[model samples]
Target: MSGKTISELTNEELLDKRKKAKNANIISAVLIGFFVGIAVFSAIKKGLGFFTFFPLIFVFMLMRNQSEAKELDKEIKSRNLHF
Candidate 1:
């Protein structure tokens, strides 16, 4: 995260950041689903072992991106901002 506070950002900057954060979250979710699907297929073809870890990693990443999106949402809300 940057040291700059959300208050320091202009409205356009804030909206852009929010849009990027939302896009990142959406991408992360899609990746998570893709990884999970692969993990399931791997489990079905080959026994579970290291292959299972990939989906877990994706899940963690998804959670992180979701948190980031939530933080952006909070900032937008605090400023009563709209895009």
Candidate 2:
């Protein structure tokens, strides 16, 4: 997060950042799906109390990463970098 601004970054740097953000988004989505499955399974098997907290935490982390990726995508788009 503490890096160059959009205007300061070279086109190659922007493309690299965009690619990394895209990969992070994909990985986070897949992890979120996996955690959601675990959460559902736990909820169905139990009464949905303390046991669901672990999966819920993971889901939150994945969601945060997804949001960060989205922000990066917006930055890239705002700079008109296609990658």
Q: Evaluated with TM-score, which candidate comes out highest?
A: 1
Candidate 2 residue runs with Cα over 4 Å from true position: none
The Cα RMSD of model 2 versus the native structure comes to 2.2
| Model 1 CA deviation exceeding 4 Å by range | 1-3
lDDT of 1 by residue, 1-83 (tens): 27777778777888998888878877877888898888888888897978866787868867865776677778889889885
Per-candidate TM-scores read: 0.80, 0.79
What TM-score does model 2 achieve against the real structure? Answer: 0.79
Best by lDDT: 1
